[model samples]
Target: MLTCDHPFPLDQYDDRVKEHLRFTGFYHASQIGIVQCQKALVNALVERWHPNTHTFHLPIGECAVTLEDMAMILGLPTDGLPVTGITMSNFETLEAECLHQFEIAPRKSNYRGSGIKLTWLRDLKERLQLTDENNIQSIGQYSWGSACLAHLYRALCRASRFDCKEIDDPLTLLLVWAWIRLPYLAPVPREPRSFPLANM
Candidate 1:
């Protein structure tokens, strides 16, 4: 049983947490319903996911803020980062497609298309059962899960460079990334309208 309710500081770093989530099919790539973006998972992924190019901080013209800065703003863990974002190129992204799919099931829905559920995420313990995928599919509501999707989205951000306006706070910029990626659960340049954040 996990005890840390706050899920900050490093609770998510606990291997048990990752195992729990993964077993619950959190890492399962076929399930296609909405899952809860547990703070534990988000904090863990932010801490675990590789960094974007620029040494540590994201480049904004001449200024830059680092993962540590973003962690500080969000009150998350900032130590022991391992990011390949700086060199995350199209080739690497292409290479990782199969691995990514095996690790995470990309939502098969289009931007504002179908297969979105908004019902309350059931008990993680219950969902952990490895039976069928996308149990939330039957719920008919939109899935509000974001942590897994966010990790994938962040990967796309790293693999490609998008023209972003000057944003002062790294926290706000991170949130903007989340807002942009979360809505459609996608991060790509398939079309300008597909991603509104492109203009913002």
Candidate 2:
């Protein structure tokens, strides 16, 4: 099975934690942020029909907090960390190393014929379209960039084949490229009166 490792340092500034929560689509609750993010991400992956059998190798300490602690924090089942091995924190450049490994990982068997069946991209596109129609302004370049990358990663992960070559179909390639380049485009601002303001 194709495995991708993402090692994030939770020890970084508080902003990093918030950013991680935002990127992973989980509420930034300190007590359960890590586990909530993990569950949200995993659930999203499953919703995309990614076979539940795939492996996720999460490293504790440097890359992230311990899964046991995460579970306790989230009040979830403790299965001794979902996957087999956790990455070590001793590695000096953990993120770079994990990304390098991800670049070469083989494709999962269950995802052989399917090419990018990610709903997140569709959802993002709808949100972007709504933003354009309503003239809603995005938070910043970083937020947009992160969203674009998330869409791209979802596309790449789902489209990947056993040979690791994304499907060469023109439409799929075009869509993926569009998502990747979304950050470069001008922001679409949300129009005034798009929604009724609540009374303070």
Candidate 3:
């Protein structure tokens, strides 16, 4: 299975930076500490997943992760419009957008097709003044919850195919939801439950 191994950087940031992340709707997500991906459980769920219907076909009944789960488990805002946008297919368009939003135009080499390198993004994030009201406002307007849930759905759909071997989605959110809803399949949470259930 594909692993989500990134660290939580919110703890490392100063209060000012944390406030900026909060304003941009990433504060709760950033607060989630990394948890081991439950591979066996995830794989079993994948096998039961019906991409056509977007639900798990368990013996009990059909169920799917709802937007409410995203809001409660991940603390994502689910009331906004669906996250949708046109692709920036060319380097020039991508560069211009980056310059406009991030105020730093990465070199063409830093981009692979339409996506920029994570390393480059990390570097830019460090260099940019996140406290700047303009930058915070630019990012805060999007429906981050919808964007996250959409990507997770897309990843689950792709991984449900017989030809696919690995999942590249937010497994933490999925696992937490499963644990809360299906206690029999869950390990005892080492910590007490918290606001974002995933943090427990």
Largest TM-score belongs to which candidate?
Answer: 3
Regions of model 2 farther than 4 Å from truth? 14-159, 165-200
Clashes in predicted model 2: 10
Clash totals, every prediction: 15, 10, 0
What digit string (tens of lDDT, one per residue) describes model 3 on residues 102-198?
A: 8789897899767887779888877766555785676777777777777878888988877877786577788888898899988887878887888
Model 2, TM vs. native: 0.21
lDDT of each: 0.32, 0.30, 0.79
For residues 1-200, could you state the per-residue lDDT of candidate 2 as single tens digits? 32332323233335644654444333222222111123233332223333232222233211212323222223222332222235444333443443464332222321223332234333333333222312222222123222323343444456443454332221222222222233343123233311111000
Q: 1 or 2: which has the higher lDDT?
A: 1
Error of 1 at 168 (Å): 18
Lowest summed-lDDT stretch of 10 residues in model 3? 2-11
Index of the highest-lDDT prediction: 3
The predictions' CA RMSDs to the true structure, in order, are: 17.4, 21.3, 2.6
| Per-residue lDDT value at 100 in model 2 | 63
How would the candidate models be sorted by TM-score, starting from the highest?
3, 1, 2
TM-scores for every predicted model: 0.23, 0.21, 0.84
lDDT per residue as tens, model 1, 100-176 = 53343223331122222222112223334443446433222222133323444454344333343211112233443
